[model samples]
Target: MQRPWVVATLFCLNAAAAGASPANLLPVAQKLPITPDNFCLGAQNVLKTAKQVLTDELAVLCTGNTATTLFKNLIAAPYAGTGTPALTQVFAPRADNNARTSEIMVAFAMRIPKTAVNTLLVEEKHAIVPYDSEAQPPPLGNQLANMKMSFQFMEPPKNEGDADTTFALQQTVDTRSVAVNFKDVSNHELRQYILHPDNFDFFMAGRTLVAPTEQFKKSVVVRGFMTDPADATKTLVVTVAHFLMNSRDQHEQLVLAFSNFLTTDVSKLYQEQIKP
Candidate 1:
């Protein structure tokens, strides 16, 4: 059983509509051997619904890409199905504080060719490449000085037919910006550039994420085998879910259920590579 307050707080955080009870908010665990027919389109529906919930609870912003804009500007559009997308947010902890906060959420399905995920990940790593921005500042507002990126892997579904996979990502950019230094540029030049552009530079690698153990260390993984009754073609169903939060308290839970499912020890590999 879930804690009553947990349910209530989540509802309040999500800005659930009237009559949305606890039962309505929890994610139903999906079972494996699910056919294309069992691959309910409703999961997308639930993700779509989060738009208003997140917008109301947090201040959001976007830059660099259109797909990202669409994902973060989720208020106006329906849940989109596409490549890995990210969301950003700027936050001020106190009225008088000069520092800012940055949060990121990333969502994408684990499909596409083997090279696709690798290629995309490399491209994404450069999106926020480090550069000296001490001379400039963010165009939106004052810099909070301190910034960190929050990453999450939302639930991703697998195809029960042929072998196909994809990944979805949502990123939250905290309002804060990290200070960057250039070895080639003079301090004077760096200062001038930052003051003019209001841009800072920083470097980041795609590090695995480490979720709190007490809470659900959610996995975007699926495990189960089933033969399609219609064709007798062997089918394997794998479902995985990912969530983002600065603190464990903010994390959400995803449940998975399947028939004749065989559990595997993927956590050891997951812990080593997935958590940052």
Candidate 2:
């Protein structure tokens, strides 16, 4: 059964202490090895390494399990609302003291049935208006589907302000279910949704190998995928794994490692599939 909710208010004698509340960032963050010159370079390296580790980790996790799923490449797209697609070589997940933050990464994964996924395509548009807290903006685009969109800020669990935020895009399609979340802030209001029908063609084209590697500290793990290894016969099924970033270092490491691993001749990490 769905749980119910209640509204509560507490009167605190020490109002100053309550005023120090911090924004809740999700996942975790750690100290990362980064320098201006090597920021993007280091992120790519970390992404490559993390992909390998994730593969191994999945093999162990799925062992003795009958999930039998194919794995695909994890793609991080440019944020919809702000920041365009730009390539930067520097590698810190945290923004410099005085620079506009790099575009947020819209990481996605496509899973295929036993039949096979010939192509992968993901198309998302920028939200027309930012989400509003005081004022409830009308529902976004009204394209409800059985998909979900989730986001988590990279903050250490030890920090009082650390929590994973999730939202489901209420799309109209599929035999599956859908979920959504909404939020509003000063500069921009935001809403994230999962659309119906996983488009495989767009991703397999290899136009954009991976997300831009800027302000991506190697200390946090952005995300990973688990898929069946490509073979001559049959098809590969895949599942994407999401990891919480507790520190800037983890994020930096994941971007660098995943980028290098994806843009290589490595079959274990990623390979072209026969278009269906």
Q: Which candidate should be chosen as best, given TM-score against the real structure?
A: 1
TM-score of each: 0.19, 0.19
Give the 10-residue window scoring lowest on summed lDDT in candidate 2: 1-10
Every candidate's CA RMSD: 21.4, 23.5
Q: Write the per-residue lDDT of candidate 1 for residues 31-137, one digit (tens) a residue.
A: 23323222222222222432112221111111211113322233232112232222222222111112221122322111212121121222223222322212223
What digit string (tens of lDDT, one per residue) describes model 2 on residues 21-70? 21121111322221112222322333242312333323311322222222
Q: After superposition, how far is residue 97 of candidate 1 from its true place, in Å?
A: 15
Error of 1 at 61 (Å): 16
In order of listing, the candidates' clash counts read 68, 81
